[model samples]
Target: MRSRLFDAAGVACVLALLYLERHLAPVPILVIGTAMALCLLLRRAYPVPVAAAVYGLAVVQVAVRPAVRMVDVCVLIAMYSVVKYHRRLLWGIVAGGGAAAGVLIAALVEWRSDTGSFWTVFSVVGAVTATVWASAYSVRTRRLYIASLEEERDQLARLMAADERAAIARELHDVIAHSLSVMIVQADGAAYVVQTSPAEARQALDTIAATGRAALTDMRRVLAVLRGPSAVVEERRRPRLADLAESGLALRIEGSAGELGAAEELTVFRIVQESMTNTLRHAGAGASLLVRLERSDGTLAITATDDGPGSVAGAEGHGLIGMRERVAMHGGTFAAGPVDGGGWQVRATIPVSG
Candidate 1:
């Protein structure tokens, strides 16, 4: 409220200057001076309003006292303020042109009665026009600078997000691949003990326990991604399909799983592990699982199909969705659905660079 009061007080001072000058017969010097001051002060908050008022006052001064030299400065100062603060061409155009036209017409009318010289008229008009053009140029330059900064800021933000996602993806793959492989190995060993080795099945349970502990450690790192990355999680190394086949996932390698980057390798291994786990869970007593890896062109394709208890909710579950995201991180294509004859099929084609 106090700030507004001061602004009003300042406006009143401008009016007071005009009134005093009118009585003293000192021309429009005080009037134009005060107009310039108001334009400078109010440009940011009230660009259009201030520009309108300044140009209007110039017109009024030209009408009342045709020989006034003070109006030029007010128009010039106001035009600059509008350009710098408002950063708009329209306001600058209106204010600048208004000042030049009003002064030129006034000088033409007051030619014989006042100084009656081309130099005086041209000088005043030239000053107003030049000031307005300079203001417009300044506004254009400032707007360009602002746009450039915003573009750069957006680019930096995207790069940071990509780096963080890469880190998080690595952590997820490590945890999931390690845990599921250990579980399959344990489940397979337990199967052999159902007859005379019941005590050995108890040992398999301990392996599951160890795998679960490792999973929990990785889960902490995965959850940290959601909280925002303050520190980089260390990369994890896990057994590949070839290394893990002994765990009884029945890993059948048709081609190379590739010595690609860690992130890509992790994605392929997780897809295989996830598909296999789903098979073991839903494929009844005698479900046959087939894991195939083939290299086609510059891509490695992994296809896991199971003659399970028919499809195993392939498309409607989180397993499928997670697999797709893992594949997509490397700009790959992932597809999973029911095969033609009552089975589940999950396929992923990830890029490789030799």
Candidate 2:
């Protein structure tokens, strides 16, 4: 619709000018000016083709008529359209060159008649054509640059969303996997001793209930993160290493983690929890495991050794991989393999700041 309005205005202006100067080759003026005006309708849709057609008629007009024509202004409009709409550099250079050449031809013809100064005509026409082309090229460059920035912003948003999902998965795995392992162990022991030992069975049942409540609380905290900041939810504190004692796992630690950052403490807690969970699920009955954490030289080192008949081959489960990723996020090193003598050992080292 905008193109139609521009075309109508261009046609009206061209016809009006030809009417005032109808005395100088009225037939050629009417024909060429009308063609140029009509071509403006397709300028945006077919910029290069319209530019080529307009310049072709301009060359013919310059030859037949010696003086500058008002219809000649359409050549600058066509040059602008070519560079503004098309992304190709070759088309813009071709259009600008064609306009310049036409301007020089008209100026030369006027100079020969001694009626107009050639330099004056060439300078004014060349400046206007060059200005139009340069302005269009500038607009095109800025538009493309903004588009690329928007694309980059969208890609970064997608990457952030993916990382958020992976974090959620890791949290769920740590919470559910650890709690279920404890409950399963307790339930199995209860089943084995329920007939002969009622007091021991009752203790196992109580432990199961406590483990379920802790798991439920941890699950709620994890879910709250997905509900957005507007949701009224209390943030859970980082898990302490001492909390694992209630889980009945034979674990040991040798250093004070009081100075560790909240993130580092949580990472440490999840690593040990996942290791204990793996030990419970993979190791057979009567298997024993020990976990040790030591701080020295501005670093915290973690080790978990289990005297279970577990092999190192293909031991990289989702839980262990998650533990490795957690440690790596803090610029830490992690390794898991079979011990030289027996069982499996998982070790990690994380840097700390005082």
Candidate 3:
């Protein structure tokens, strides 16, 4: 709507200019000028057609009219509109044709008029034509640059969103896999000794319930983060090295509990959880797992060793792959292999820098 209003205003200005110069030009010149000026009304919407009409009128006026009128300026505006909105190749052709026609008209008018010099008339026409075309071409280049920037921004946004989704998937996999492994083991143990050891079976049931509740809480936290700004997301407590001991795992920390970014902390916690879960799943009941965290020289080192009959070669699951990806994301190194004489071990070293 705004553009249309601007085009209307341009057309009105041209018409007024033509009316003021009506007496100076002949009837044929006046008619051609009026047609060319009116064509500006459709310049933006139909730039090529308006340009063609203006150029045709210019040719007719040059052939018949004795002198140029103020309305002749509308040709430059039409040329500008064509260059601004049309394709580059088309604009190039129009600009070339307009320049050539302008030179021819200047030569013919100079010959017809006995007063003005040829160079003066030609210089004015060439200058106006070049100025309008150059201005429009610059504007076109700027618009294209801006559009390319917008496209790049959108692409970057999509990539970031995909990265975020992958992170969420890794978190969910760790939470669900660990909790389910514990619950399943506890359930099986309870079923086997229900009659012989009623108290032990009841304790196993309680453990399963607690694991389920913890898994549910973690899942809700993850979902809240994914649901966007409208949802009131709460900061949930993330697991630390101490959490391993609290969970009754045979875990020990051997370094200062250095401060870590939220992302690094979450990655460490999930790696530990998944490792312990895998140990429980493969090592069966009465198995012991050991976790160690060490901070030194701006690097965090994590090692998990389990006294379970596990093979690193056989540990080809999504959980292990997720751990490797997390380590790699922070430019860290990861290794998982069987110990010299016994169980399996997983180790990762992550750099901590801004």
Candidates 1 and 3 compared by lDDT, better number: 3
Model 2 gets an lDDT of 0.82
Candidate 2 lDDT over 209-318, as tens digits, reads 98898888788878888888754247554577777776756666655655888789889899888888877787666666787778888888988888877663347767
C-alpha RMSD for every candidate: 7.1, 4.9, 2.7
Candidate lDDT scores, in order, read 0.67, 0.82, 0.79
lDDT of 1 by residue, 150-192 (tens): 9999999999989777667655755575478568767787887
lDDT of 3 by residue, 100-218 (tens): 68766775677578767777777877777887778888898898899999999999999999998998898898889888988887888899989999998998898888888888888
Q: 116 in model 2: Cα distance from truth in Å?
A: 2.1
Give the CA lDDT, 0 to 100, for residue 11 in model 3: 85
Highest lDDT model number: 2
Q: Which one is best on TM-score?
A: 3
Candidate 1 residue 321 C-alpha distance from true site, Å: 4.1
Clashes by residue pair, model 3: none
How does residue 242 of candidate 3 score in lDDT? 56
Candidate 1, pairs of clashing residues: none
**In candidate 2, residue 1 scores what lDDT?**
79
